[model samples]
Target: MEQPKRLSRLKTTALPTSLSDHAAAFDRLHPQVQRWVRAQGWSQLREVQTRAITAIGGHRRDVLIAATTAAGKTEAAFLPLLGAAAARQDRGVAILYVAPLKALINDQHKRLEGLCADLEIGLTRWHGDAPQGPKTRLLKSPEGVVLITPESIEAMFVRRPASVEALFGRLDAIVIDELHAFLQGPRGLHLWSLLHRIDAISHSRARRIGLSATLGDKQHAAEWLAGEGPQPEIIAVDGGGAPLKLQVRAVVEPPETSPPTADLEARSALAEIARHAHEILRGKNNLFFAGSRANVEALADRLRTLSEDGGVPNEFFPHHGSLAKELREEVEARLKEDRLPTTAVATTTLELGIDIGSVHSVAQLGAPRSLASLRQRLGRSGRREGSAAIFRGYIREPYLAADADPLDRLHLPVAQSVAALHLLAERFVEPPSGDPALLSVTVHQLLSRIAERGAQRADQLYRAIGRDGPFAAIEPGDFADLLRGLGGGEEPMLEQAPDGSLMLGPLGERLTASRDFYANFKTDEEWRLVNQGRALGTLPIVNALAVGSILSFAGRRWRAVAIDDPAKVVEVVAHRAGRIPKFDRVSGEPIHDRLAGAIRDALVASDMPAYLDPVAAQLLAEGRDMFAALDLARTPLIAAGKDTHLMTWRGSVANGLFAVLLGSVGFECETFDVGVTLLGTPSDEAAHVLGALDGCPPIETLGRFVSNLAHEKYDDYIPEDLLRRFWVKRHAHLETDVADMIRRIALALS
Candidate 1:
């Protein structure tokens, strides 16, 4: 069905009367919609909303409502969508609400339910968590909006492919929420392919509307949201609710910890945080983002213990994927009402806008993985007029060297983090890079599509997907590699088929696509720690964990469980009472590489940055006195402290290169925070390291560390195959202009 024709002059009411006669239409909105808008306290329509209504509602284009969250984007997209559906479909779900998380769909469904309840249109949520009854009704009646998660929609795509044509025949639009979170990674790519396929089967065009909060680059995001460069109506939000109030502080416990000692472990930084959290989160509603789900569980237990000991009500709660959905949802709902005196210690699960009430404050337990996350957490605070983020940073103070960089100071990391947040909040991150790991996700999805379709012809399948689409850029070589992985020439698609026909095999089926095959996000490597016939969730199977050691698993301490190599399982019995710090990842992309350099420059400029924190003040004073005495900052090779110490502000990777280069010159070099310390002999070694490194000899002196590596996902897991791939790739761009960056550093230092 086509959109209703614009029979006469249509103009926005707000437009001046002289021009209104030719083009005003908004003032003519149905009386009920006008009333609804007024009651909702909307003063006027947003540009995105007006544009959507104009381009889509007025002309009926396959609209793409690409805008940020809390930008009234949901209403803008849906109001026109609902209007379009009202004109045509009275018998089926006209709108499909698909989001990555169930919480987002739930939030949208409820909001729409109130609006459409009396409009004779029904709303139905379909997901794994949804009851079978409503889904059955939607299948039977095929009316109203069917809110669903991507996985559930993927299931429907397989189980009811035939019904899809009928169910979504008049499908007006699809509203994808929290789009930025899923759209780039494997999950987004999978959804995109599924959507393209859904269009193929439905025989109806569904207007796509993607909603997100953090849109770093709107143009690129729009391109991804609308496949084949659909000329999506780009809707950059103008007036988001409010700006963020951010305050980052690092709490240092009494008694210094230079070299890690047993007593320091007992009195950990977490203890100091627990002390402050008791005061900071007393009256305010808060959400503390712990980077790991493991940390969520551990922090919950700690908070519970704190409440018990302090005789205060337990306001903190654990929230993540591991917790039962019912429990998690209930907690979330309660949090929204502001009646529940609770603070959720969560992973990124709670990061999206799920309307968990006007939180008075937000807390980050430790160094966050990215500046993007830090900004999101900070945004959660001061939702009302005058609230601020109670961000607290905690680091293991015990593990330190005699000469730790000022940046390692507890407060310095937080300060640098704040600076990074400022850069990100302004919407920049070295800009967005194209997905390098997209092939992995594509492989995952291809396997899933095959599983669902049962058996499909190679040519037909490839044509259906690759022709005139995002995969158009995908090469024949990569496709061949994927086909091979899917049990083809080298990798068998099915067990018996040497010809590599597309069939789901045991190997291909074990991937996530088998589980649902829809989600493309990377799964973490975990070792299920089991003890005494019970399951402990999982421990990160990193080189960070060693055998014969007692470490925290889940919330309790367990002795180095028997490391089952084949099973990749660790079996252990409870040991003493100690906990390992559960950190999911430590990724720092400060505003720029210059931040580290700027920090060093700041140290030299004045004592202000050094004396900012009490503990850092003493450390800085000692370092500065030493620096002046040795004249270390001025000279590359200085003997101010009675020995030759090389000071280079070339950053970590470069400093590491210097160390490797020193070895090339036959001089063993040790790296310190400020510079490199030459060991053994400096005369020949110093010349060798510099000659080997500066001359750009990949393997002349350093031998095989460059090409020895294959691939490594984890920092410590730099396998021989990985390490070669990483540094060669890591400094790939640097190879072009690094001479200048290095030369500048060398000249300045020299």
Candidate 2:
């Protein structure tokens, strides 16, 4: 193989020799790097590095470095690569670093820049935020290492073809950071396509290494990260990071004496949160990860009240995507400066690998959503010596009604999943599964191909996409339909050329050119509920539009003061909502099949423990007494408390189905959030809805129906109306499964 001439011809003595050789390389680290490590107390290299060095020394074809957060995976991936880069002698984006988040790339650049000084490894992060100078330099001379977000990488192939070819031609290895986040979205598909384009352009297959710990599913995750061609070896280190302390406590707000208003509950909860936060705030800086922007602002506002009353400086900060960059950055800076024992109430903006000061604890208002989330939140703490991630999850309730479902008793199951991830210190992690709806990625990649090789015959485009692209298995009929739609028409997002040279159609242009399209994060496009342009806080599209309608949000209420109808904005002056509307966060509930089954098994095996604090314990006892008196857990239908009905056997989704179907069965019924309610009188014939729902709604079932009434943003783009049916029908099986589970309980108890 002829190598590039800009050569060092240097020996990778560090890699070829044993760990001691690499250790020796580290010994001569730039004085600054050594001092920094020593200042943090000279500890031995982590296991991730120990194993990585051995693999890199052997010139291991590919490596996957899996370890817990704060376990030094970055050092593991880069330290060994320094040798290979030094040996290859030619520099041109010697390594292509890909991370799921641009912020992560920035964080990695800051942490790795000092170490690079010793080896003169030029490192830079390229993304929407990255300026043109370094990118231009990479184009002119692809020397050194470059870091980029998956989105930026996609843009590189499409917009900067020549630059990518030149820079990546001598690429030695591509490092994928935070590997899990990309394995299941349009972003992942785009990332894979980008890698394929690199191989096609450069011709020489580059070695690959992946860095992640909190990955939920590594087996599938590794394959996704590996791309389709040129398989890579996997290297995972049991991080052996510090232990985490996690606890979930339920917070029950007193039921409103009057109408349910959001502001009232928010204010009420805020007071309690302030008291608890005050005690915890006495320690290191903390982060409270809320599920939404409204929650962040409300939590921050309430916490500020505590400071005001305590005669202390304001320590509570707010962060989310909608906040102006300056405001968000200032909150981050204040925490970094240790200006006070501060805490920032934030949404997923703080979820990425952004580097803020180490904290003593993390608090979440509800479920952490995914195992990976639990791992990331816990990682925020324990960054310093003897520090541990202390998390307190609060689930506010309308006072556990007399007859809540047994499953309701199992709310902490999500917490259990989080605990399992934290057990990663013992070297265990779950890899997430690849999602099937990565069609958005396919569109992005296809457009990149069209841009590279200006128009293609319809058939050639099909072969390229189906035979070679990630959509290899897409049915021919569907593939043809898609092509016909794309050939030349008025595209809302894509601006088509007359001869079909597939320029970015209006919709395509908006989607591809904007930084937002690259984000696979399914955050709803929200607007700040501003009062005179000062954001009262942000609200979802649906909530913001429902102006003048009485609604509770952020535990506070205000008549939607005014609606910026054009901008889709709402401004609510804070008022009391005694009970807050539970935000319907759309992330899939991680239903561990095994754990759910285990819960059923546990239910039959022994008495389930009262997983409640002493106060809730008494309430739970009353709850159990109420259930026993009503026998609601075993019965399919029970008219229990005044307005409440119990249906313990049916899960939430199933109950929803049952309620909807019963309405069709001539029952004066409507679905309540938890159970079915009869508007007036209910007949026993309504029970027939259960069996009727078992079959499909009959393909041609009529009721002025329409196709593609989808909610998720990507749901529209893929144009998979039929497949959407499949997903609904498939998920409908959950109702069936719950029904069966209910039957078992009913029969066993009877």
Q: lDDT per prediction?
A: 0.57, 0.58
lDDT by residue for model 1 over 328-445, one digit each (tens)? 9877987888886778888887788787756776777654435556555655665564444445544333334455332233233443443344454455533344333344445555
Please, what is the TM-score per model? 0.74, 0.76
Instruction: In angstroms, give how far residue 36 of model 1 lies from its true place.
Output: 3.3
What's the C-alpha lDDT at position 283 in model 2?
43
TM-score of 1: 0.74
Q: Could you tell me how far off, in angstroms, the CA of residue 623 lies in candidate 1 after the best superposition?
A: 8.6
Identify the runs in model 2 with alpha carbons over 4 angstroms from their true place.
Answer: 1-43, 239-241, 258-267, 334-339, 400-437, 468-470, 488-522, 525-612, 620-633, 636-686, 691-750
Q: Which candidate is the best by TM-score?
A: 2
Worst 10 residues of 1 by lDDT: 708-717
For candidate 2, give the lDDT of residue 609.
37
